[model samples]
Target: MPATAYDAKGLLKSAIRGDDPVIYYEHKRLYRWIKEDLPEEDFTVPIGRAAMRKEGSDITVVSYGLMYHRSLEAVSALEKEGISAELIDMRTLSPWDREIIFESVRKTSRVVLVQESSKTGGVMAEVSAAITEEMFDYLDAPVTRVCGLDVPAIPFAPPMEHFFLPNADKIARTVKKVLEY
Candidate 1:
């Protein structure tokens, strides 16, 4: 999920009726930005499945939450530069969609994982590890991570917060670096 309001209700319903615990991380920044019309009937988006927002062949960009939107922006920029990027939204972070990720990497031969969490021990670390362990032979370049700085706490000021967080520019830069490698 891209942390949009469209799937919020479904995620909530899934959490309530799920057999095991579900940890949903709501992005505070998306609260005011994302709005959508949801279905009137009750629905649940299953956990552990990733949504492929865009299809491409050059590189694969895997992300979740706010970073997913940012990754799309970066993908758009890359598209302008003649680089096709496949964007995947890992809705469930705990049980990430390994099948989709492996397939994309196998086809594109390059990948970059974007996240807003701190770089140290962030979710991307596990994703990178998985790719290295399972898809090493498919990779043309090393897995790149576009993540927040290794800060103890997020900054309160807008400027500082922007600096600490991963944005489209940062993601695009990382994608370019990975492509060059």
Candidate 2:
């Protein structure tokens, strides 16, 4: 069965009440979502690890999941506009590589979180809050988030799906605004 908001709420309640480790399915998806390119002997890519896609002094694009691919494309487009962006793929969410993100934020001081979720109370909120709370002084611009508008995702129609997801154009625009701050 597909996950629902109710299910997530119940899971959280149970975990809190029980106070025990809960191996959530969300973790499994990231672990196996993309086929590992590393050697078989060293199969571990290390969950909670952050990998840098590009290095730049202008701005940093932080993203994960399918959004990670989209950010890379945006980086290419931004390059044509004479904007250099560094992309970081945060594979694991729970044990996210805060050190990597903090270091990059301290260096560039501009961050745009790209996530394919509702803009309201989404995972991007947590990231933005953390950055502001922990590395506020390092930032030159306000941390911005590029997320799908508050709407449900469509399964079949291309146009509807497009409307439900954050595209490269939206990301590029958000990045430009962040740079201006």
Candidate 3:
């Protein structure tokens, strides 16, 4: 659910009212970082729906979890450079919203996927493959991914972990490269 502030309640509700087993990932780093005033009334954010975090015309950035936040930072930087980037928060990855992704890609003609997982066989791989298979003709540039290094595990040291994970600079650089292509 992108590990955002608004997702905690919805995730809890989904877990409580599950027809099947549901697995939820909570980012510990966001525990103190994200806070929001949610609606008092009961509600359930539908599963399998992605959220359009930002809209733009130049390029599309698809991401989930903490990477989604990082992508937004990159998008902000790109905006200052006159590169409008559409950011999509992939709330649910299992049954992701391909329609939204395709629509954005069609409009922008360029895409950059960001994720914290390893570059090898990560969620971005599946997403990039789907885009290539379904929307190759619509793309102006090859799909690019800003992902973690292909390592056995994330490093415990802050510096090493920073280097291992995808950050705003990496995302911004990749987006610029795609736009320039």
lDDT string, candidate 3, 1-181, tens digits: 5467777778668767979777787777778898889888887766788999999999999998888889999999999999999999998887889999999999999999998889999888999999999999999999999999998878989999888988999999999999889
Q: What is the TM-score of each predicted model, taking all chains together?
A: 0.94, 0.77, 0.96
Q: Native-vs-model 1 lDDT?
A: 0.89
Q: Which rank order by lDDT, best down to worst? A: 3, 1, 2
lDDT of 2 at 140: 95
lDDT score, residue 173, model 2? 89
Clashing pairs for model 2 are none
How big is the positional error of residue 174 in model 3, measured in Å on the Cα after superposition?
A: 0.5
Candidate no. 2 TM-score: 0.77
Q: On residues 119-160, what C-alpha lDDT tens digit does candidate 1 reach at each position?
A: 989889999999999999999999999999998888989999
Q: Which model scores highest in TM-score?
A: 3
lDDT of 2: 0.75
* lDDT at position 147, candidate 2: 90
Give each model's clash number: 1, 0, 0
